[model samples]
Target: MGTPTDEDDGVAVALRDAVRTLTLDSPHNRNALSSRLVTRLYEELDRAEADPGTRAVLLTHTGNTFCAGADLSEASARDAPTDAPLGLAGLLRTLVAFPKPVVARVTGHVRAGGTGLLAACDISVAGPGATFAFTEARIGVAPAVISMPVLPRTDPRAVARYYLTGERFDAREAARIGLVTCAADDPDEALAPVLDGLRRGSPQGLAASKQLVTREVLAAFDRDTDTLAELSARLFASDEAREGMTAFLERREPEWAVRQTPAR
Candidate 1:
C-alpha cells in the first residue's frame, strides 16, 4: 500500500475534503491492468474503506488513456495463463461492494476491461475527449469477466454491438447506453455537484443508498465470477487467441481479419 508521499507508484493516493482520489499513473502502458496495478488498487480500496473520513473514492487517471485494458504484453509473455480474470473479478467486486461511493472521472480512452472498471462505479463522468471500446473480441476473447459489472449497468443492445464488433464510441454514446452517468465538455465541472452531494450524505445513508442499486450487481458477481474467470482463462490459452494477441502486439492483422480465398 502506498501513502500519499509515494511518488513512483502506479497508483497515487491522496485524501482531500473527504474524497480519496486514486489516480492511475502508469501512462507508459496506458495504465493497463497489470498484476502490480491490480494489487495496488486492491490495497488502496482497502485503505479507503477503512478510513472513516473518506466519504467517496474518485478513480481517475493521469494520462491520455485512462486504461487500455489488460496488459497484453505481459499476457503474451506468460508461460501459461494464470487465473487473471479471477484477479479482475475480485477487483470489480471490491469496487461494486465498497461502502463509500465509487466515482469515475474519465477524460481519455478506455478499452476492454477498462470499461468494466467504469461500469462498476456508482457514478461516472466522461469528458468530450473520452472514447471507449470493448476490444476483447479483436484479441480472440470474449468480454466474459467484465460482463458481471457491465451487463447490469448498460443496455444489452449497445453492449452486444461493442462486445462483438470492438468498435470505438465517443463518450456521448457511452452515456446514452448507461455505461456512464453523463458526458460533459468539462468532466471536473460536472463532477463538482455530484461530489458535493456525496459529501453531504451521511456515511450510513450513502452506504445504504448504494446497496439499494448495487444489490443485483453484487448478486451477479456471486453467481458468475467463477464461471467467467474459468472461461476467460480457457480462451486466453487457445491458439487463436495467442495468434490474435501476437498480431496486436506486432501491429498487424490477425489471421481471422484476413480475407479468405474461395476454392473454385
Candidate 2:
C-alpha cells in the first residue's frame, strides 16, 4: 500500500496492492471543480493508468458534501475562454473508457458536474445521506457537455424533469432512477464486500466486460448536434445565466426579471 501524498490540495492519491484510492480533498468548497484541481486529477489518473502496480481506482471525497460541481466563482471570474479546460474533458473521457474498474464512493450531496463524475465511474456506492441535483437549469445553463455520459445511468423521464427543474433528490430517489447502484447506511462497509469480489476477478476479464458494455451503449446512440448547439448558444446568451453568475459571485439570490408564479 502506497502512502497518501499532499502534493495536490484537492486530491490525495494512495496505492494499496492493486488498488489505488483517489480522494477529493477540498472539503471547504465541497471539492468544487477548480481548474488546478481538475488538472491535477487528470495527471493523477493518467499516472495510475500508466502504472503497472495499479489495477483498479476508487474515487471518493471528504466532507459533508461529495462535490457541489464546477467552481462557479472561477468560472465567473474568467474573462477570456469561458469553457472548461480541454484536459479536464479529456480526463472525463478517459475515465469512461478506462480499462480498469473505477468505483465511486459518494458520501454526501453531489450536484451538476459532480453527478457527471459519478456517472463516468463503472460502479458507484452512495451513503444514505447522499443527495443529488441537476442544477444547471437553476443557474440558466445547460449540462449538454455531460448529458451523454449521465443519460446511460438515468431514465429519460427523470432526466427531463430534473434537467428542466434543477430540483434536488435524496439518495433513495437517485438509486430508484438507476443513477446509483445502491444506497448504503455505511458506504465503506457496503463497498468492502464488492471490492473483495472485484479483487478476485480476472483483471483482463473485468476490463473486457467494461469495454463490451460501453461499446453496446455507444452503438445504440447517435450524437444530437442540434440539441447541443442550441444548449450552448442559449447558455452563453441567457440573461438568467448572467444573473446567476453575478449573484453567485456577490453571494445573493439572482433577480430573474420574470417572477415565477405560485403553483395553485
Q: lDDT tens string, model 2, 154-199?
A: 8889989999988899887888887888888988898888787777
- Residue 215, candidate 1: Cα error in Å is 0.6
| Inter-residue clash pairs, candidate 1 | none
| Colliding residue pairs in candidate 2 | none
- The local distance difference test score of model 1 is 0.92
Where's the lowest-lDDT run of ten residues in candidate 1?
1-10
Estimated TM-score for each candidate: 0.95, 0.88
lDDT of each: 0.92, 0.76
**C-alpha RMSD for every candidate:** 3.0, 2.9
